[model samples]
Target chain A: MSLTRRELLKFSSIAAVALAATGCSLTEPTSENPESMGSVGMGTPAELAETDAPKVVIVGGGWSGLSIAKYTKKFAPNAEVILVEQRTEFMSCPLSNLWVVDAIKLEFLMHDYLQASRENNYTFFNATVVGVDKTQKIISTSDGDIAYDYLVLAPGIDYDYSEWTSDPVLERRLRTEYPAGFKPGSEHISLRNKVLDFEEGNFILTVPSGNYRCLPAPYERACLIADYFKKEGIEGKVILLDENPNITIKQDGFRSAFEKLYGDYIEYLPGSKIINFDLDNKKVETEFGEIIEFADAAFYPKVRGSKLLEIAGVAKDSRFNKMEADINVFTYEVNGYPEIYCTGDARPMGFSKSGNTANTEGVYVAKQIAAKINGKKEMPAWESPLTICFSAVAMEPILAISINAGYAYDEKQKAFGFTDVYANEKWDGRVGKNNGKGLMEWAKGMYRDMFNA
Target chain B: MKRRSFLKVVSATGMMIAINPSMINQVLRADDGRLYKSYARVQLLNAEGTPMTEQMLETSENYVFNYPYEGTTTLLINLPNESAKDVSLKDEFGEAYLWKGGVGSRRTIVAYSGICPHQLTHINKKDSFITYRKKGERFEGHVVCDGHTSVYDPEHGCKVMKGKAPQPMASIVLEVGDDNTLYAVGVLGPDKYHEFFKSFRRELKEQFGSKRNAKKEVVSTAVAMRLSAYTQEVIQL
Candidate 1:
């Protein structure tokens, strides 16, 4: 499904005529359809009836959706921006390792979207998006169907536990009982409390191979938990089973931290695949015919684009099942639908699936939409997204190691390539102490930029 | 000069003073003190308690003196006339101090918690984490967290004017001594230990009665620094 330049131009002409007939211009606020007026929260019906402005509907309120909402409202104040997120409060997956180890309180990680909505002058609907009707340019939500000139899908990721366990009963137990705490909320908190309570016993943490959100996070969790064990003087061992051949990212720092800090407490095994889980016995059987028993366990199952993507008819037939976005790279528009864009973790790009990348891409997509709406020619080339990842190595002294990478958009390849990449340098005690502090400072700025400003 | 231009001058001066402390004396000595006196009432001081004279402020534009006291750091900006000022409240510190507008010779002097309200990370002038903005004719100062850009306005008790901050930036109440030195007597709003201890001390005194000889114990600067550092680490984590 690819949109050619000629087809895009033809569509634009048809859209312009349609928009003119529907009175979706800067002069009028009210759309031709009175039904949409009741469903969409642009403003009071009276106020909205006065001016016809373009409407941008953003689904999901994580890093990407929030950023799009902010930037769209910023660039086009007259545009009616509606953000649809199911969750009432924003929870960050980045730096959640601190929360898991009980180093930080949950309150610090949660944020309300009210400020973002109010400050940006956008309407925020706490409603789940059910389906995207691209033909009608309307999205069906739990609240109602809302019309949109441009639709942005940032529904995040969902776990694919089918390969691991086919039995529905076992899968439900795996999700609820053993649990993977990747997604922020009650499950994360439960895992944290469980780890804290576990005394002298085998606690197993497994990491899935391939692309996952926050690549260094699983290792960071292991290090932080090991640090917790050392701090409480607990007699226990943490078995770290990795499906990947080796540490995926920030390898030097994590590898060194494991070797030097948690040499005795953590056992790292690579290329170990968990074929099946014996829920009755609390044990997992690896493909190598080795069965590992655990008192407490967390298994990160393979991930795919949220099921909503499949319903939207944008998901690719791949293992990870990401959205099939056009190769423009600058504009993350879906191949056949110029009015629709897919961003964040759901979109298949050359970049790693992380919060920072999602944020950068969200802003880029917003700008691209603005440019198109304003009828600007020659869209600017996208800059490479900056990536900064920090891993907490020790809790007592409160130490952390960091990786900083800056990317540049390659004109020839039409993809982002790393301009500068620094993995693990020697751990500086000062940076380690300061990075923990830096993470919060950085997160606050990011949240403000995305949601508030 | 217009308040915005004056602030630009002050910001430049602050950058110079940051590079060289001795430049403080030179800048202060060169200033006429009229504009400085009109814009800022209190003398900006370092953590070590050196009075940042008007000349130093006049010479440099971005003169932000980092003052570390009682385990936490406070950023003292010479609030320009264009900076947001509120004169609604009156306290025991006198009508002048209570209100944001200057009382007598002292101009409106305000200090904010160096730690960001959202995540307890330290906000500093060097990093541009905390900045003063002159939007058109309206003047405002905001603390910007790099992590999430949560902006807090200093005028309305450091309330979150923009961003993801849940609460206002903690404000440090200041008093000018007879000799024109600024003294931090109390803190109001967010951050943990300072607010906790301040309220705890007040409650204890109220319960024990005034005559119980509840002498205010001055915490050593080292202990305060340690506590501030510890608090920042814990809150951020």
Candidate 2:
């Protein structure tokens, strides 16, 4: 499709949102045509067997996109579902921290969208989404055009390196020089190589502000990297520069591990919010007035919804799309586009953009999409998603934490109070292995539900 | 019987995929070109080229395979000594991988990882040989992953017997330096072992054919009986 740069950015942003809607995973592969192109729909063939299948177009086959596709296939199996993703396979950002430590390979962390969505029985377009016209309910991709009854936006976050650091080359150098390895691919490999090469040097980790993917990830990264250094007889310290006062999730557990086992090797500089960086000097000047220099640095920059969400007029003050504060869930049909839904990291929910959270949101949204298509009146009672994260302490004694948040009306105070559900514990090593197995099964089951089921 | 028959059955009783030593040199070549080449010239580093720990050397002496969950490679370990006993590790499905005796003269027991070639399921040990089945057959007497029927040759470098799996069981190199102490030289794989022979294909076709022809019938007849025994233990959660 011939799309203008502006339209491309807009569509790319929406595609990002659609991708995140599926939790950064592509839809199941369609066996007939290897290039299973298009977006997620409300139903496949079987679910829409009785009712006329709604033509749902999902852009970007990442987590959020795949989730919407999965649920849609389940409840409305007869719906004409279309998923469009640029990548052939989906690589997870959840366990990516292990890739930085050479514990897991990138291939091991990736899933074939085509193979997974084979039985999904949808038109799969292995092409980049370019533009979407909500008025016409039509989305255009690199390959062709698709019409949709319901549009799901979840393209996932883009590295607005421009927002944090202006220089893409410098950003490239930061990864090349110090090995930040924030995003994926070579960056991860470089970071791993840098870590293995380092016998002893100051390793600095900085977490940028605003909501980002896997809030606890940077801390976990720091812990794993630190463990690697310690094992290698490296005489160094991992200095953490928090853009905020403290991390949002399991901050205490990370701090305890740092202090207890790696007391001599680790240091945390709270409120060391990095304003910008001078890549040449290898220095990041923070808002808290600390100019820190390091032998190596890993930066986790701030996150925002895909640019399409903003162009669609769904994004709020910051780049993130605003969620309805009443429920704190990021599921809404835009005023102009009533048939479309936005969720996940792309949706402006004041929550950590995590795999578990996004997965739960995807399931919830799927159920919602099913209800809407079935002509149900009342929207299902929206329950807050439970958040669970596994953080390995040197690939041993993996820690697990479950988190949930909800709204409750305080009649006595005539106001609203938050019912926060949070639990943290050290998962037994064997249990953690079992959890890994369980998660693998869940992925397989989820893949089946998206395609076969 | 011909000399080949005595050699055939006994040899068939234990299978090992011969690996080339140069593959290890290549991976280490990236780490430190000089050190790897130096070791390659000496050919002292065994299969994996990963430095062996004292614990691994000791374990290799008694058992051919030790499931060390803590190590980088979790499957088979090869011992350098020839006197070590042949043993098998089985999974819940009764699939097995053999941990054949010592690879060298150091009396060092080497254990290779028993993870299947397809999915990374740990190979189970049962009786004298670790055997894995697919659908119902003994998976042609090869190590088959329960998740997907990817096969492996444990005696060798855990080479893939069949299916889409490319990599082999990384051989844990067993070495005894001048100090008379056993050490894991390195891990062995196609990338590490393909240099020694003009790619033998590990004779997987013969191995698979022999096992399949010898026993064509399904063995899950016993597996169904085990499932019923477990049903009584469940209280309906």
Candidate 3:
């Protein structure tokens, strides 16, 4: 845990004055007033535990960052690793859909960052990164500046509601009121409340174009909400608005659930893009000239890498997403900056942006960073990140569909594509129950892998 | 790996005996488990309290036994053919070690830590994602963990044949006594016992009643039984 901003500012200023009085270069940070460092935020050194070991600073405490921190420390024990995250606690995004519908408790989605740090022997600094000094190898946070020998930026994803609406007021209203709930924390809570307190009329959800975070999540959310409505005997329906022509993933299973299970509760619309939104009237105009009305909606827009990549000067437009990290595909290092690495949802790769993908990819990234730390000349060979995702189609018994796949670089396409794809699209009878059990087990295993159980 | 009718599935969980931690701590402590160290030469007993010998083994079944530590479950398998010899393997941390194949008259018996070395997916009391697949199965003649689909070949010292397992499963060095009693002596390759204990502390508390009870080192003998009998739900993928 970190001190409040006010306390830190005062403490840092006092320390700076004390250092100035002594007139010796005692610390790595300059003896300047932290308030004077405008864009830099905090000029004072972070009040971290003193260590002479090589510092490996990681930004974000999500699945990717957490895994990298733990595995990097495990593989290279001598390195002093620190994970800088803005959030106080970690909330899992994978099984959070279950949490949204009251199928699973909030405790299941939440994890203590301090516990993860304590068990893994890394420092979890609760601070938001304000800026980075590439030349000095220092990342300035709201708390203070932390210098590092190696830096890993794993800021996940940011919602791009630009294409939906250019009006800032409309966008702001969308963000605060009817949020996409892709990111963890408040958005998820808001979404959960919106579903639980919902009484009647159509509850609209959208499937955004491009390789969005958790390809099947929107479909799963629709199904779960429809199931909730069906179970509660609520006079409502879920109008699923998909930009794509058909179901992007686990089509058979989701279609079956929509038809066989929640026929009256769900209205799945394919290739229906919201060209115009009438939030005032609770209606939206689709691209194919279909005007849809709703009582409530969660507009999940197109996803792009976090704006942190642009701030770090490592951003570029990828084939799939805009403003993603421009890095060597094999190694996660920034184009020319070997010491700086960018991973997780910010990467330009076409890998599925799910918790499982991030965790597996994080391990591979950790290996590359560890190799450099261990004084290895050559980085390890490129490894494929396994994407194992499970989507719930029902709630009472929790019938689900699953996908287990790995990626391989395709020379012809000059890009990466899913290989060894295994899909279990059966969500009926005992097989569905088994898949449901597998889903829970997979999640627990993933949680244990990322955190220290 | 389909669910079979478990007719003779025995429950011998009453045989759990806690040993002195201080005494076993000396032998259990290893840097990377690179050094082959011996423990209690416990006899492998089947469901009927009869010592398991060569004739009583099934080639297609997955057997379970706790070793070194109570929470650290291990897999005992009798392959259909003679196991390969002197298979070279590497640990997750890039340390290389040799696995000196299987034991018994037909050289078909092999044992490995049930816990996956990659993510520590193990044979848990509730459900086991890791188990042996029978002949003509998806991962035929291999121990497949459905969690991440990590397939380990018992014929080649449980070497990872597919999926994302960082290292091969740690081999349980077994020996046949003069009286033909099978005993697990030591472990070869890198073991995740320490990490396993550290990772599953919460589950350990629930499963064994306390962390200390779960961490209790195996001293005299460990009950060997079928995987289906050990875990309540043995999931198949």
User: lDDT: which is higher, 2 or 3?
Assistant: 3
Q: Give one clash count per candidate, in the order shown.
A: 38, 107, 0
Model 3 chain A — which ten-residue stretch has the worst lDDT?
A30-39
Task: Identify the runs in model 3 with alpha carbons over 4 angstroms from their true place.
Answer: A1-39, B1-35
Those runs of model 2 whose alpha carbons end farther than 4 Å from true positions after fitting are: A1-53, A160-182, A318-331, A377-379, A396-422, A427-453, B1-237
What is the clash count of model 1? 38
Query: Candidate 1 on B22-71: residue-level lDDT in tens?
Result: 12222221132111111122344543555633323321022233232323
User: Candidate 3 at A336: error in angstroms?
Assistant: 2.1
lDDT of each: 0.60, 0.50, 0.82
Docking level of model 2: incorrect
Best model number under TM-score: 3
Q: Which ten residues in a row have the lowest lDDT in candidate 1 chain B?
A: B32-41
Q: Give chain B TM-scores in order.
A: 0.46, 0.34, 0.84
**Candidate 2 A-chain TM?**
0.76
lDDT winner between 1 and 3, please give it. 3
Task: Calculate each model's fnat, 2 decimals.
Answer: 0.19, 0.00, 0.52
lDDT of 1 by residue, A1-453 (tens): 122334333444554465567656422224353222212222111111223578788998998899888887776677878899889988888878887888887876888798789867888888877655466566656664566789898887888787698898988998998778877787787888888898887788888865677778888888888888887898877888898899887777788889988998899888888997887888888988898988888888877777777667667744344433333355778777888888888776656777777776676678888777777796646655556666777766557766656667767976566656655334446656666555655765576566542
TM-score of each model, paired residue for residue: 0.64, 0.55, 0.89
